[model samples]
Target: MKLVRYGAPGAERPGVLDAQGRVRDLSMLLAEMGPAQMSPRTLAALATIDVERLPLADAGVRLGCPLGGVGKIVCVGLNYRDHAQEAGMAVPAEPVLFMKAVTALSGPYDDVQIPPGAQKVDWEVELGIVIGTRLKHVKKEDALGHVAGYVLANDVSERAYQTERGGQWDKGKSYDSFAPVGPWLVTADEVGDPHALDLWLDVNGQRMQDGNTRDFIFDVPTVLSYISGFMTLEPGDLVLTGTPAGVGLGQKPQPRFLRAGDEMRLGAAGLGEQCLKCVQS
Candidate 1:
């Protein structure tokens, strides 16, 4: 089941993507795709609805971040060993967690805003986990049970603000339009094994990041459970599982960065794709 939210930015209506790739409105049944709609119980109830009877949305409309009322966007850095190596950083003993301001959330195909004086803007294509229930100190075995679904995300960053600034990674990562998520919030069942999926990112139609989740140093379950041990995982919260090794910063002697009018295309198996146009804000 591919859950969706469509319409203009601030006035989205809940919907779902049918098997043949049509959008079926769910707004009549569920007013909004928020914490209530994101819960496991609500999802189960939603599955019982006959999609064919639902109104067909127009051919092409703006898709908002699948889930609304998102509380926070958590991220695990260097979860992929190769990514850590490419960044010339040591493999962390545990997941290196960070928070992305929820305001950064944007529609999948939206243009990524380049902040003023942004010199080292970069991109990190990552798999985003959506929490279904509140969890705290949960065991590793129960981690998957708490996940609502997965969404494709571009963890856009500004290297200078992330490193050069004498502060945390928040400024570099939490800019508005920094996190463009979702073509769909694919249900866990449809996604099958998140561990073996093929995920990649292309810059201006050229492939730059290509890797599988199998190489993750600390897989999804561990990362989630590890996080739950310290912070409360609330429904509608998103967790980004980190990117592979091919980020622009990982390039040879001279690293490349995003420029105005540059395009970024990325996707993962089962999950849908995302296309972002970079622009100066």
Candidate 2:
């Protein structure tokens, strides 16, 4: 099922997509899509609703981050061999984990803010995993059972703040609107094989990154189980499984970066696309 949240930024209401790709309001049946509703049982119940009967949303309504009250965003970096090589870094022995503040969460099509004096802004098209149940110290074999769904994400970053700031990558990654999530969350059952999806990103209509999940050095279950060992992952918590090569910093003729007014269009198979504009703060 394709689950969504549409309306103004903070007032978005829960919804589901109908056969024609129209928004069918679920507000009457569900107050909001949050941690509790992400559980397998609740999602199963939601799947039984007759989408054709729900009221359609107003035409062209703004979409908000699909899930409300997101707990935290855990990200894995350098999990792709090509991306690590492009950045001149070694492929890690284990998942290279990082945190993107929940505050960075934004709608899939929202404008990404470029902070003052920031230069070297970049884009990363990645597969985002949404946790459905509490998981702690779970083995890799059982990790898939805790996932609710997946979403496409653009992990907008500022290369300078991330590398030259003399601090953790979170400094450049936690900016507002840096984590534009979904047009909708495609349930686990619908996604089929999480590691076989194709992913791509374009800037101003020019293709910048074109890759596939088949190249992942460490797959989904490994990432989830590895993370759960240290930090408890709860429903509504998001995990960005990292991006493949072709980021701005990896451009051949020096590096290309985002300037105000640049538009980024990106997506993954099964997960819908995202169109975000870069704007100055």
**Model 1 Cα displacement at 149 (Å)?**
0.6
- lDDT by residue (tens digit), candidate 1, 1-281: 99999999999999998878999998878889987777878889888888888999999898989889999899999988888998999999989988899999999999999998898999998999999998899999989999999999999999999989978888899999999999999988788888998999999999999999898888999999999998999999999999999998989988999998999999999888999999999
**Candidate 2 residues 131-175, lDDT tens each?**
999999999999999999999998889899998999799998999
For candidate 2, give the lDDT of residue 124: 96
Q: Give the 10-residue window scoring lowest on summed lDDT in candidate 1.
A: 34-43
Q: Can you give the TM-score per candidate against the true fold?
A: 0.99, 0.99
- Backbone clashes for every candidate come to 0, 0
> After best superposition, candidate 1 residue 209: deviation in angstroms?
0.3
lDDT of 1 at 77: 94
